[model samples]
Target: MSIKKCRQEFEKIFKKYPDKTQALLPCLYVAQEKCGCLTEEIVSFLAQRLDLPKVEVYSVITFYSMFSFEKKGKFVIRICMSLPCYLRGSREILEAVVEEALCIKPNQSTEAKKFTIEPVSCLGLCDIAPAMMINKKIYGNLTPQKAREIIRRYKQEKDK
Candidate 1:
């Protein structure tokens, strides 16, 4: 979707709030979802639309981990590197499963731009340690093989 189109859709969301400042977070989410990431252009455009200072918009965007400031792949693979997942051998999974299978290390997107591997903090699934999330879906208690299978499925779906 074009930025103009996204801004048009945002107009409806913006209308819900009498105070445009109250619309900041939801407006940012809408922009991020539509534009794939929050670029400088998008941020500036949002500030103008919301009638807020650009610094205010940038500050909010920078504070949230869910909101990406840089371009990311369609599928972002976030492996939990918290204490529980670490104890469950998340390091091994990071190296063996993500790196070897996808040929992309943590914080790197695949050359084909299909996926990005990120090592994040706790994802609240400590009972099922060594958990990882692809987009919003969490897979836990993973073996290297299971991770490989998940990646394969996504790749196949993308291919199709």
Candidate 2:
């Protein structure tokens, strides 16, 4: 669907809430789903639709790391860098994954336009240390080899 269609759907959802302020979260989510990141254009569009000031929308977007103002790759790879994951070799795994998959450092998007690698804090799955989240799916007990395999599968699916 186009971004315009997504915006219309978001406006419809915003109308359901008694207060436009309460619709902020869902609106942002819709924006992300539409554009892959919450761009300034989307924020302004949302502000106009909800009759809210641009500052309010911009503030929320800036405050939330989940909302990216810049473009991201088709696949977002979030590697857990918390204590548990680190102790379990998350660093090495992250390095290998970035080098092999994206050929870029963390917080960088690949030239292929297929993947983006980021070092995330805790994924809240310490029991399953060395975990990584692809898009939104969490994979635990990760190894460098396993990470590569998962990336391959994701690339194949994205290609289809």
Each model's lDDT: 0.83, 0.82
Write out the backbone clash pairs for model 1: none
RMSD of 2: 2.5
- lDDT by residue for model 2 (51-107), tens: 899999988887765678767888889999989899999998898788886578888
Candidate 1 displacement at residue 125 in angstroms: 3.1
Instruction: Give the per-residue lDDT digits (tens) of candidate 1, residues 1-160.
Output: 3477477778888889879888889888887777777877777888898889999998898777667876788998888888999998898888865666788778888787789888889989999999999988989999877888888898888889
Tell me each candidate's TM-score.
0.82, 0.82
Worst 10 residues of 2 by lDDT: 1-10
Off by over 4 Å in 1: 19-22
Model 1 vs truth, CA RMSD: 2.4
